[model samples]
Target: MPKTFYQFLMTQRNPESYDTIANFANNAFLDSAFPKQETEFDPLSKYLEENAPYLPSMTIFDDAWQLYLASLA
Candidate 1:
């Protein structure tokens, strides 16, 4: 059997990680556009707007990975 898109993405190497970061950023923006409810930290629109400045820098997989780790702490 062949690897699916998700499987391929998960197994990507070095420079290919940048592409995965881009895809994750795109999906996050799309999902946040139509959020189910709103709250202080949960306000999708505001969160997206505030994070817009970081988008360009986020193109790097390492930066995006760090951001994800920071969010968890």
Candidate 2:
């Protein structure tokens, strides 16, 4: 069977919880209070690292929209 997006994200071993952090950052981008400058990326990254420490455990809850788009080819 093919690996689901959640499975792919879960299998990432480096940076430990990058997928989780990425998800949080993506959500922040949709918020009205989200910063428009690139400089805010680091702060958001830190926030996810600190607040969502169990990002890996929540893998199934996160959807891989980008992966779905890539599959259209």
Candidate 3:
């Protein structure tokens, strides 16, 4: 089975590459309203843009997302 977004983020391939994203994922995991299961980008993007503890560049998200998509295959 494919991992959830939160699951994927928490499972680090390279600890250094995901430092910021892992921090955000930790935060997101705590939030009751976070859409942890949804794989679609737009809602997740909006949530990250608005609710992140610190603003991470969209490029970081895009790269993470590409990896997530590949994992689904």
Candidate 4:
């Protein structure tokens, strides 16, 4: 698997909301708030909800996350 978000993409081929999505994930990872080992469900979605009060709206997170996943395909 990729080590970092940048490495994961390995290219600029992403949707318009890619940066926003990546920023959140990278920050969450860097801040030790991302549950990297959680296998029961989607970590990104969980992180976004857990940090909703401290970050932007869930709509943005949801959109960006979906776009990011699409870009990976």
Identify the candidate with maximal TM-score.
Answer: 3
| Ordering by TM-score | 3, 4, 2, 1
- The deviation in Å at residue 31 for candidate 1 is 0.9
Candidate 2 structure, TM-score to reference: 0.26
Model 4 lDDT, residue 37, Cα: 47
Off by over 4 Å in 1: 1-18, 33-63, 67-73
**Order of quality (lDDT):** 3, 4, 1, 2
The residue-level lDDT of candidate 3 at 20 comes to 61
lDDT of 3 by residue, 1-73 (tens): 5677767876743434447656555656567777778778899889878877554587777777888888888
Name the runs in model 3 displaced over 4 angstroms.
13-32
Global lDDT of model 1? 0.42
| Whole-model lDDT, model 4 | 0.49
TM-score, candidate number 1:
0.25
Task: List the lowest-lDDT window of 10 residues for candidate 3.
Answer: 12-21
Candidate 2 lDDT over 1-73, as tens digits, reads: 4444333433333443455545544444344443333223246345445555444543322343354335434
Write model 1 residue lDDT over 28-58, tens digit each, in one string.
Answer: 4444443323322335335545654434443
Cα lDDT computed for each candidate against the true fold: 0.42, 0.41, 0.71, 0.49
Clashes of each: 0, 0, 0, 0
- Poorest 10 consecutive residues by lDDT, candidate 4: 2-11
What TM-score do all the candidates reach, one by one? 0.25, 0.26, 0.67, 0.44
